[model samples]
Target: MLSSYNNNKVIYSGTGRRKTSIARVKLIPGSGKLIINGLPGESYLQFSPNYLRISCAPLNILGLHKEYDIYVKTQGGGLTGQADAIRLGLAKALCSVNPENRITLKSEGLLRRDARIKERKKYGLRKARKAPQYSKR
Candidate 1:
């Protein structure tokens, strides 16, 4: 038997992928604060103001002005990769909160996963595509 209290507080989980990185997010309705793992808010290695700004954009668009703290655990990504992953996670979380907002968020393309990665360097090349000095003598 399920209790009524559990109904109001929904636990929504979502995953975001970018390049080789992956981010997993669990959203619960509460005060505004970002948590990664069991550590405090300041413990996450990829904390960035810009990331938070971009990730939280969906909340604002959905008219959820008040703070809704999020608990996220992300791995296999760099700082920028993690940020974009978080953004996707946040967007999915917003959708879970209310399905009606899907059209709005979808139109903005916030749900899309970025698939750009570093190009591997080719043999005999200085870089991914740059070639060594050519001699025609």
Candidate 2:
């Protein structure tokens, strides 16, 4: 997590990961706009309200949804994982903005990273755990 000033404007940044997804988030003081990977957040998320809500959960929890703009660069994984990663990153940035926010974010479990990832496939297995059908005739 880091916060820096650009042209006298403050920017708070944080990184988050979920599954195979990684999101780099920045919080800028402005109207509540969300831009991801140079695209509008809504369009990037395919206009799914669930994704929008998940990505902005932290700000909504803090009643600062309209206070800061969210900018993110995310890659890998599906939309669900990306959305969660963004949420965590945003929460971290908010904490940098106000350390006290950690208490609130933590209580809501927003600061915790989801560690579950895809299981590796073993030799002779069809998938991570599924094996080919056996014929004992």
Candidate 3:
């Protein structure tokens, strides 16, 4: 996820995944601002305060919400998935900036990957676990 940064500036980065969504996130020293998928984070999320909060949970939890700018490129899944992915990626970037953040992030459960995804349907079932019907004649 972390590509590179020039020596003239400092940037931290990481990758985050949720469901089928993936986000590449970068953090830079600047006033709080967010750019995601070529759109401002707020605008991209349709100005939904809830999703904005979810995407910045890790920063808010660590009191760094106003200290850095966030950049995210995300695809796949829906808005919620992308937001959670950003949160996880931001947590990882924070850890890279300060190792001490590792414990905090871990304690906040931000460093854990969400592995749950859609289950495949079984060969003889209509769904992952549901059967077509029961005949008792």
Top-scoring candidate (TM-score): 2
**Alpha-carbon lDDT of model 2:** 0.95
> lDDT rank, highest first?
2, 3, 1
Using lDDT as the measure, which candidate wins? 2
Tell me the lDDT of candidate 1: 0.73
Stretch of 10 with least lDDT, candidate 2: 1-10
RMSD per candidate (Å) reads: 3.8, 0.9, 1.6
Encode model 3's per-residue lDDT on 1-137: one tens digit a residue: 34467575688999999999999999998899999998999999999999999999998989999999898999999998999999999999999988998999899899999999999988999999999889999
Q: TM-score of predicted model 2?
A: 0.97
Q: Against the correct fold, how does model 3 do in TM-score? A: 0.93
* Residue 40 of model 3, lDDT score: 98
List the candidate 3 regions with Cα displacement exceeding 4 Å. 1-3
Which residue window of length 10 is worst by lDDT in model 1?
A: 1-10
lDDT of 2 by residue, 40-92 (tens): 99999999999999999999999999999899999999999999999999999
Model 3 steric clash pairs: none
